[model samples]
Target chain A: MPTVRINDENVTFNEGATVVDAVAQTTGRELTAEGKPADGGRLGVAVALAEEVVPRSRWAGVELSEGDQLEIVTAVQGG
Target chain B: MADMSLPPLQIGGYSLESRLIMGTGGITDLAALEAALVQSGTTLTTVAMRRYSPETKTSVFSMLERLGIDVLPNTAGCYTVRDTLLTAELAREALETDLIKVEVIADEHTLLPDVIETLEATEQLAERGFTPLVYTTDDPAAARRLESAGAAAVMPLGSPIGTGLGILNPHNIELICSRASVPVVLDAGIGTASEAAAAIELGCDAVLVASAVTRAQDPTAMAEGMRLAVEAGFHSARAGRIPKRQHALASSPMEGRIDLT
Candidate 1:
């Protein structure tokens, strides 16, 4: 089992969890068939692991360990 | 409808006929915002990133999608290269676009770009193969450096953001335009129609407007004004103006002037 911090929320998951498993636990959202952090319309959310972006392609394969830091962001209004 | 006859404004792989790139901010009404988008005839516009909030949050993303308008996601409040990089990465994953408007500010009071961080972010973004439209100061030398760093566009403020002060340093804008190989964008400090014209005439490839239009009491009319102003500015630039003189060189020939004058 690994304890990872996502967007400042510390989430613990079953042992031998990948980055995908951590994201599901952290955001509590369902993954699409293509296996991305998305909800129907895709909030345009981006995820970063350890300050480096975890590309969507590699999300399923990259495993997470204890204390790994994650950041999730989405598009908002601005000038 | 935007006139398609104008010479296209090209940035990276995108080419837009309209030189006005509007910002989706200030105005709270969604319908009115859509109306303003159409009125402005802007091919590209900006949106900022925020932490996701689901319960009370409705998607402006859907509204933009319905309008079929392309979005240029921005890092509006990022204070450092690290924050900006993450924000930009999020925007890309969420928006599925490479277009980013990089705004790395030093503080909220000034809302101005931090020169050192802006430069650093631009170089890194380019290295990562993302197209960055950097918001930089009006320093021509810095503008050159940003271009060298592979910025898709160099957007320099005419003054501070939202001040409506117009172009406080026209010469610097002109100087930046004169040297830049990439498009020079006049961003922020635009208060009215003429300033937009001046920015275009000074050789800016495009103008990014927000408060001057979206916040106007008459936003719809203001939006139209911006559209026409951008075209007029581009036209005037192409038409070419006579050199400024200390004394008037009479438009009417000397011989045509009345002797009584």
Candidate 2:
């Protein structure tokens, strides 16, 4: 089991876990997990791993390694 | 009439026709951006990556290219060196240009560049052969350091990114100009034509703005005003200023004058 660090918080994942999956599991917030209220539903999440922007669709295919830093950014609307 | 010769300014090996560098964001559309660019007479325009849709190639790049203007791609939303570098690489590939507008923002509220991360990204980009146009704060020392680190130009913010507060620190901007060997372009917080003019008058080589022109009531008209303001600022800078005098000098012969009855 390889460990991953996201924004300095450490999390464990099974072998061959994608960066997106690891983030969703660690945060308890569904990235692709949809169907909630408009204000409370998960809008979208953008992942930046090792300083490269990985598109949402490609996040599932991206293989993660130990010591890889990831940034999971979610968008929120404001007036 | 007087001689109208002015020295030319070079940036990233390109001879700029004007010191006003426009941004491609916040416009109604590509047509409006083109019109504004034409009216401003700026050779370079900043384009952000986040605004681009990867799904569709329909973008302002082709439009700006058709207008015969140079594109300076910006890393507007990047907060780290790695993100900035990646964005720069992507921009280079997409735009087919090595010129980059590097913005490492630590705080979204202030839109201020993270000096440490910005310098780090700058060093990496410079090593990798990217001409980084850094958007920094109005700090003279930081501007000098950026120039020393191989920045194509130092773009200090007049205030925040879109507040249009104008030049909050003219003295610091002047200091940056006096210290740096590269061009000093005022990057943000410019709300009107006068702010652009003031930046140029403070010895900045150029002004990079978006909302001021694109979000105005009439984009084309505001663009024209910005053009004239930049021109006026350039002329004023070249014309120099009247030296301040501490004591008054007698215009007439006051010491030898006779009293009248």
Residue B179 of model 2 has an lDDT of 85
lDDT of 1 by residue, B1-261 (tens): 756466877887777667888888888787888888889988788999876556313256667777777889999989999999888888888788888999999899999889899999999998987889999999998899889988999999998999999999999999999888999999999999899999999999899999998889988899899989988898889887878889966566666555663
Question: Which candidate number maximizes DockQ?
Answer: 1
DockQ of each: 0.51, 0.05
Top model number, lDDT = 1
